[model samples]
Target: MPDGTVPQSVLEIRRDLAAAYRLIALEGMDDGIYTHISARLPDGPNGEKRFLLNPFGLRFDEVTAANLVTVDETGAVIDDPYGAGVNAAGFTIHSAVHMARHDAVCVLHTHTVAGVAVSSVKEGILPLNQWSAQFFDRIAFHDYEGIALNLEERERIVADLGNRFVMMLRNHGTLVLGRSVAEAFKLAINLERSCKAQVAALGMGLTPVVLSDDVAEHTARQYQSAYDAMELGNQSDPEWAALLRRLDAVAPDYLG
Candidate 1:
């Protein structure tokens, strides 16, 4: 390939990832310059993998397609036009899943208020609503291991994630991954809302009506099947499309 030329496919991934950042900001899931979203670039013919990650210190609202940086599997910045760098902790978490799960091409992480509150609970992601049910028995829980800057934590992250698409970082935040930026966005947003619902219910300080085990499992299967079809069909999620359209109206520069 040319020295400075980027593949058109990677350009598309850049746009998708940038759009996700802006949407995360718009949806109140972003935590200033912290918490990052990343998308995997296509592997080279020699089997080298690369990724697109948001630059550290740049708020999600400030992200644009052309501003995203390229990084290697080792989390080294390869093509950072702005030299803003990526969050070291972000690299640790995102790279673990990106390397461990080929199907998880896009990873979304958030440090929302509700997410952190529920992360401390021993019972994680209860089936308080249909949204919560979608993650029933499918959410991984990784004990908060301090700041996550330690390189050794990567193995533990991958081990805890263990084929799960959603996870709670005990006393920390949340992590979600998917085959596409759109799918990851959908999962992250729902998980956020579900966390909100749980927090709200618990705050009521009354006996909450939780779903039965059978119904929770059945509900989870329903959502899993729907997402499975979306992934297997190689189609964009409807909600993602609609959100992109909405973003176009408010933040069209995401595609730049």
Candidate 2:
């Protein structure tokens, strides 16, 4: 609330989360005017329960800490510099996730070419290769509706998401929810990679080298650990650091 140095911890989390979104954009995961990312404000000793998200019209690569909007649990914009407010439609999608999923601190959605392509497949994500191995038996699929603008649809969305971190919105796109921004980003990255590889394999008409059930199970277990994102203060994740630098090079004004 003050203009002085932001608390080191909060500043770091904000930067990391913003950086992740920009990287998503950089990696060609954003669909024209769709997709979004959200982070639940950390619960402090006093039990504060706010959250941070992007303004509806801003490009992901153009997002920054100062531009991020803080909103209450009810989806009311608390302090929005752009005065654009939260994407109510996006809120409907994300709030249902945040409310039902207590551990879901960050939610990232994408509508990449590969993601939508894979979502359209009846089989969903297969154990095509190692890239696809991460989601071996872990992908959830949701039937396509026209748009995600109805609050009433929240129940269905939750039911569709179930207990999985990666969800494919049939004929729509993909989503990854996690306990932290870094965790969510990692999941989204993997999901996109899996989809891309699957699309490539499909293009080549080559049968995918499916993984054994045992190995797929083992890989999923290894990916289940909660990410240590608190140490992101120094960009502990090289990938994240490199992503921020990439964004800086391409869209430096996003740091506004």
Best by lDDT: 1
lDDT of 2: 0.76
Indicate which candidate wins on TM-score: 1
Local accuracy of candidate 2 as per-residue lDDT tens digits, 156-175: 98998888778999999998
Give the whole-model CA lDDT for all candidates, comma-separated. Answer: 0.85, 0.76
**Candidate 1 local Cα displacement, residue 90, angstroms:** 2.7
- Give the backbone clash total of model 2: 0
Q: For each candidate, give its TM-score against the true structure.
A: 0.93, 0.86
TM-score for candidate 1, please give it: 0.93
**CA deviation > 4 Å runs, candidate 2:** 1-8, 43-48, 225-236, 245-253
